[model samples]
Structure formats: C-alpha cells, structure tokens
Target: MTELVRLTGVSKRYETTGPPALDEVSVEVGTGAAVAVMGPSGSGKSTLLNLVGGLDRPTSGTVEVAGEDLGRLSEKRLAVFRRTHVGIVFQFFHLLDDLTVRDNVLLPAQLAGVPPRTARARATELMDALGLGEKANAYPARLSGGQRQRVAIARALVNRPALLLADEPTGAVDARTGAQVTEILRELNRDGQTLLLVTHDRAMADRCAGRVVELSDGRVVASTPAGVSS
Candidate 1:
C-alpha cells in the first residue's frame, strides 16, 4: 500500500528545560490503514497526533503526510494543506451551536472552495449515511451526544481528506454511544479511508484499527496487530 504518513526520528520539546514531549519517535502509516496510538496521560499521544495533523511542528526530525513535508511548510501553506488534505475529529463534538447539522457538515467543504451545490450534496449524503438525515435542520444543542459526534464525523469527512485523525473520539460519550461511534469508524476504514486515532479505550482501538502503537513517556513501547493487547 502507499504510505500516507511518515515520521522520522521526531522529537518535540517545549522548552530547553525538562524532557521532550516526543523522543525519537518514528512511525509510518499506510494508505487505507487504520492505526491507533494509545497511552496514558502525558505519554505524548496527543503530541504525536498534533504533529501528524499539522497542528504543531516537532523540534527535530520530519513529519510527512500525503507526500508533503509538514515541517517545511509556512504557516499559511500548512493551514491550506491541512484544509485540503487532512480531516480531524476531536473528543468533544466541536460543532457550532448556531449552525444546523447540514450547515456544520458543509462548513469544511465550503472553506475548501468546493462548489456550494456539491458541498450541499456531500453533506446531505453523509448526514443520511450517518443516520442524521432527519436532524439536518437541527442545531447541535438539540442533538444527543451520539448524534453530535456523528455530525462531527460528517464534518470531518465532507472534504474527502487524504488522512483522518481522530483524538479520543469516544471519550465524551456513554458506552453504547461510544460503540456506535466505533462502528462508524470501522465502516469508514473498511471503505478505504486512512485513519489514525489517538485514544485511551482499548476496545475502540481493537474494534476500529488494524494495528495499535502503544506509547509511554513519549516513546513507543509496542507496535502490534490490533486485538493483540499491548
């Protein structure tokens, strides 16, 4: 498979003092693969995710996603690249409370310069597929946690990004809702979406990812096939 993400000897240090947030971390994720990065708090899981998503730059080494070197891009270029090539879903549903579900889903595509008609169609299709078709005119505050998250997922995917990065996607939901989200992610991956998820839930990782990379103290401790407990 083609490579979608690559990190070589990556390290991130906030200040001259203290240990690096990431230490010599190297990881590769191939196209259409779903990989989970899991660890306890302060293990650099978020740091790794941010670097891969182009939200932050590493102090040393390189980060390449979809054949573009993120570390080399200017802030404006990087922002454009992220808008065009990456999709991100956060633990909290970051939907705009004032916007309707359809509007929220169409926001990314609109910002990316997709035609209004095409964006609307894509948003409609995604909302329908995610079982949110009836909720299209509703605002986020009126939706259940699961429904909100589904909206977030739809918004993330409307632009058809090359890589999807989810950070603790199920962290804010109940067990049943979390499972529902996991299934959605699994189905998306099965349909050939490249996914990299950073999560603490082993069940979520096992259910949605093909491989799991475990981290501790900013270092990779294990890399194994999913369901093989780290």
Candidate 2:
C-alpha cells in the first residue's frame, strides 16, 4: 500500500512545559489501513492526530501527509492542503449548532470551491450512508450524541479525502452507540478509506486493523496486533 502519512522526529512543546507533548515520534500509516493510537490523558494522542490532519504544526521535525511536508506550507496553502487531502473527526462532534445537518456537511466542499450542486449531491450521499437522510434539515442540537458524531463524520468525508483522522470519535456516546459508530468507520475503511484513530477504549482499538501503537509521557511504550504488550 502507498504511504498516506509519515512523521519524522516529530516533537511538540507548549510554553515552558514539563516535557514536550510529542517526543521525537516517528510513525506512518499506509493507504487503506486503520491504525489505532492509544495513550493516557495528555499523552499527546490528540496532538499527534492534529499534526497528521494539519490542524497543528510540530515544533521540530516533519509531518508529511500524502507526501506533502506540512511544515513547509504557509497558512493559506496548508488550509488548501487540508481541504484537499485530510478529513478530521474530533472527540467532540464539533457540529455547527446553527446549521442544518446538510449545511454542516456541505461546508467543507463549499470551502473547497466545489460546485453547489455537486457538493449537495455528495452531502446527500454521505447522509444516506450514515443513515442521516431523514435528519438533513435538523440542527445538530436536536440530534443525539451518536447522531451528531455521524453528522460530523459526514462533514469530514464530504470532500472524499485520502486520509481520515479521528480523535476518540466514540468518546461521548454510550457503548452500544459507540460500537455502532465503530462499525460505520470499519465499513468505510473496508471501502478503502485510510484511517488513523486516537482512542482510549482498548476494545474499540482492537477491532480496527491489527496494528496498535501505545503512548505514555510523550513517547511510545508499546505496539502490537492485540492490546497486550509485546
């Protein structure tokens, strides 16, 4: 498979911090693979996800997504890069409270300058895929946690990005609903969407592609096909 993302000696630090959030971390995810990233709170799991999705930049080293080095791009170029290549799903649904579900999903494609008719068609397809076809006109506040997250996923995917970055997507929902969301992600992956997910739920991580990377105190501690330490 082709490499979709790569990090080389990546490290990030906040102002006068105890230690960097990410410490010389290097990893890669190939096309169509699902990589599970597990770590304790403040272990830089979200930071890693952010960098991969071009939401944040590294303090040192490099972040390459779809072969483009993000550190080299200006803010405007990075915005275009993000829209063209990456799709991000957050732990929080991050839906627009004021927008209808269809409008929310259409935002990315709109920002990317997709034709209105084409963007609407794609948004409709995504809503249908996520079983949200009936709720297209509803505001996010009217939806349940799972439904909101599904809407967020649809928004992320509206542009058909090459990579999907999810940050604990199941964090706010009940176990059953979380499982349902996981299945939706799995189905997408099977349909050839490359996925990288940051998750605290070990069981959920295990259900993804057999590779897992565990982090602690800003460094990787273990990685395995199963949850057990190797």
Candidate 3:
C-alpha cells in the first residue's frame, strides 16, 4: 500500500519547561487504510490527529501528509492543504443549528469555492449514501445525536478529501448510536477512505480500523492488527 501519512520522531511540547505531549513518536498510515490511535487522556492521541490534520504543528520532528511536509508549509499553504486534502470530524458534532442538514454538509464545499450546483449535488449524494436523505431539510436541533454525527461525516467528505481524521467520533453518542457510527466508518473504510481515528473506545477501534496504535504517557507502546489487545 502507498503511504499517505508519516510522522518521524515527532514530539510536541506546549510549554518550554514541561514534558512533551508526544515523545519521538513514529507512525505511518497507508492509503486506503483505517488506523486507530487509542489511549487514555493526555496520551497524545488527539495531538497526533491534530498534527496530521494540519490543525497544529509539532515542536520537533516532521509530519508528512499526502506527500507534503506540514512543517515546511506556510500558514496560508497549510490552510489550503487542509481544505483540499484533509477532513476532520470532532467528538462533538459541530453542526450549525441554524443550517439544515444539507446546508451544513454543503458549507465546506462552498468555502472551498465549489460551484453551487456541484456542491449541492455532492451534498445530496453523500446525505443519501449516509441515510440522511430525508433529514436534509431538517435542522440539527431536530436530529438525534447519531444523525448529527452522520451529517458531520457527510460534511467532512463533501470535498473528497484524501484523509479523514476522526477524534473520538462516538464519544457523545449512546451505545446503539455509536455502533451505527462504527458501522458507517467501517463501511467507509471498506469503500477506500483512508481514516485516522483517535478514540479510546476499544470496540469502535476494533470494528472500524484494521490496525491499532496504542499510546501511553505520550509515547507509542504498541502497534498491532485489529482485535489485538492494544
């Protein structure tokens, strides 16, 4: 498989005197693969996701995503890179309550300068694929937690990103809903979406990802195939 992401000896420190959030961590994610990073709080899983998604930079070492060195890109270029190549889904579904589901899904593509017709068509296609076709006219406040999350996923994929980074995707939902979301992610990966998930939910990790990387005290302790105790 082709490598889509690479972090080599990467370390991040929020303060000059404190311990780093990540400690010389090295990881690689291949194209069309789903990899989960799992750990307790403060284990640097979210930090790793942020760096890979171009939302933040590391204090030391390199982060390369889709053949571009994140450390070398200017802020403007990085922003553009993120819009074009990376999509991120947060734990809390950040849907705009005022916007309808379809509008929320279309926002990213609009911001990226997609033609109105094209964006609408893509949004509709994704919403239908995610089983949100009937809810497209509904506002987020009227949707359940799982529906809102599905909308977020649709929004994240509107621009056809090369990498999708999900941070605790099922954190806010109940077991049944999380299971639905897990299946959605699993299907997405099966359809060739490269995913990097930062989650502590072992079940979701095992169900959605083919590989798991375990972290502790900001360092990777294990990298194993799915279903292994990571």
Clashes of each: 0, 0, 0
Per-residue C-alpha lDDT of model 3 across residues 65-169, encoded as one tens digit per residue:
999999999999999999889989999998899999999999989889999999999999999999999999999999999999999999999999999999999
The sequence of per-residue lDDT tens digits that candidate 1 reaches over residues 98-182 is: 8999999999898889999999999999999999999999999999999999999999999999899999999999999999999
Model 2 clash pairs are: none
lDDT for each of the candidates?
0.95, 0.91, 0.94
- Candidate 2 on 1-230: residue-level lDDT in tens? 88888899999997666789999998888888898999889999999999998888999999999889999999999999999898999889889899999999999999999999999999999999899999999999999999999999999999999999899999999999999989988888889999999988888887765579888977888767755644
Residue 32, candidate 2: alpha-carbon lDDT: 89
Residue 180 lDDT (model 1): 97
RMSD (CA, Å), candidate 3 to true, equals 0.9
Give the C-alpha miss distance for residue 21 in model 1, angstroms.
1.0
What is candidate 3's CA lDDT for residue 213? 97
TM-score of model 2 relative to the true fold?
0.97
In candidate 3, the residue pairs with backbone N, CA or C atoms under 3 Å apart (3 or more residues apart, or in different chains) clash, namely none
TM-score of 1: 0.98
